[model samples]
Target: MDIRFLVTFMEVAQTRHFGKAAENLYLTQSAVSARIKQLEEYFNAALFVRNRNSLQLTAAGEKLLPFASSLADTLEQARATMNEESIQYLSIASTSNAWDMYLKHKLDEVKGHLDHVSIRAEICSHEQLSRMVHEHSIDLALTTLPFKSDDVEILELSDSMLSLYCSVGIIEEALEHFNISIDWGQKTNEALEKIYPEIKKASMRTGSLQVALNYLSTHNSAIILPAQIAKELVNAGKLHEVDSLSPLTVKCYLIYLKQSKDARLKKFIEVFKGMIENQQGR
Candidate 1:
């Protein structure tokens, strides 16, 4: 049977009025009636029993509602797969670690691999990251902890080693440098407290690692930063590592839709892996 017939049947069953269904489907009422009549004739059974005041689905129509709904869903999925649109859209949310180290170095790689997409990045907490993914507001994320979502696919990018760092000038008078939570959240604050139980006083509560870096640069304060970020700064003679805690490694992951089949996304993953491997070798 024609798909139009099933569509008309479903719409009529839902609205229970030929005129309303026709208006919804952008068809003439006569056209809608004809399609339903054709469907009934094809099935050799009545699909709807219409009276002067009301329309009721016949047994056949009642039985076919679920199947019709399934067909519509399948068609929607097929349309998404077969559309001729360019894959130029991607939304990403990440933790502070990603912004500090990997993103700047991988800009050229991202442009080269994902030529079609214009990247937009948001730095958010782990909980905000999870909510964005769950609500389908964000397409992907780079974070220390992978989101606990069955609908998301996570790929481990690299293990970030944490190290205390400070401005070059402050390295000499290290007593002025101290580490605090990247933000005011209890989780980050507690983590910092546990690491340094004796140092009850924090110089400041910065909003993000990026902000902390800026503060460290200007105020000559110290903070724990990812080893990759610290090493890059030290190499450029911008900052130096402080000696409070040794390097502590935490895994970073890239997360995306479980069913994402975009070629650009695939190419980006491959190029990113190569960049990470090259970094490791260096």
Candidate 2:
């Protein structure tokens, strides 16, 4: 069976709308419909219940979902392993915030331990990181979100606390006009919303901590930042923490395939373990 059909089926199952799945896969709606029909015929079962306003998976589709995901992942992993001799780089995927705040430095340290391994870091959203890891597109992932997969191993790195921070003299003015928000994770977002329900709009909203730092350096802005970073800036007299608001905590995790045994990946995991140990010691 063509793997593309399984891919199309999984996409439609995820999006639940053939049109939306077609858009995401860059295929025409007719093509997507044809692929679904092909897969249904091959399996001798109707995969989807077509409703006028919504689409839903039939019992067969539901049963096939997990198998499809596993097969796609297995095929991708086999391809990557087969091409390993030709491609000599370890790919690391991270959220922009994690890349900026921590992983970049740790990866640099990991590079020093390796002789000739090249490391490529890609910044992506939290949602995409798990899929990339499952597909073997990335060797490792650093994220604040707790990602669970039977095919992957997850290590708890540390808990980072986020606190409200601003420049020296305009805490009040910054609070009113220059409040910024960062996407820490779902839990932190919900906690922040509960704490400041009236503050609907921010002067700026972003996922990059580096961007928020740059904006804060030149402007009288206030934002929530990792306590470690905010403390470093405060020690340098560049930013100050708002003493009134409590801090929100987020847990960080390092993720990789359970079956990964690449030399570069093992070396990086050692470095990450040491880094986590050092952080815990402090």
Which candidate gets the maximum lDDT versus the true structure?
2
Show the colliding residue pairs in model 2. Answer: none
Instruction: Name the best candidate (by TM-score).
Output: 2
Off by over 4 Å in 2: 1-88, 172-174, 244-247, 261-264
lDDT of 1 by residue, 1-282 (tens): 767568888999989999898777755576688788888888899998989999999999898889988988888786687555654666778877665556656666667767667778888888888766643457677877666667677887777666667677777765555645464345545665687653356666665667777666667666666677677688999877765354455567887766556675676667667877886899
Clashes of 2: 0
TM-score for each candidate, following the candidate numbering = 0.58, 0.62
The residue pairs that clash in candidate 1, if any, are none
List the lowest-lDDT window of 10 residues for candidate 1.
179-188
TM-score of 2: 0.62
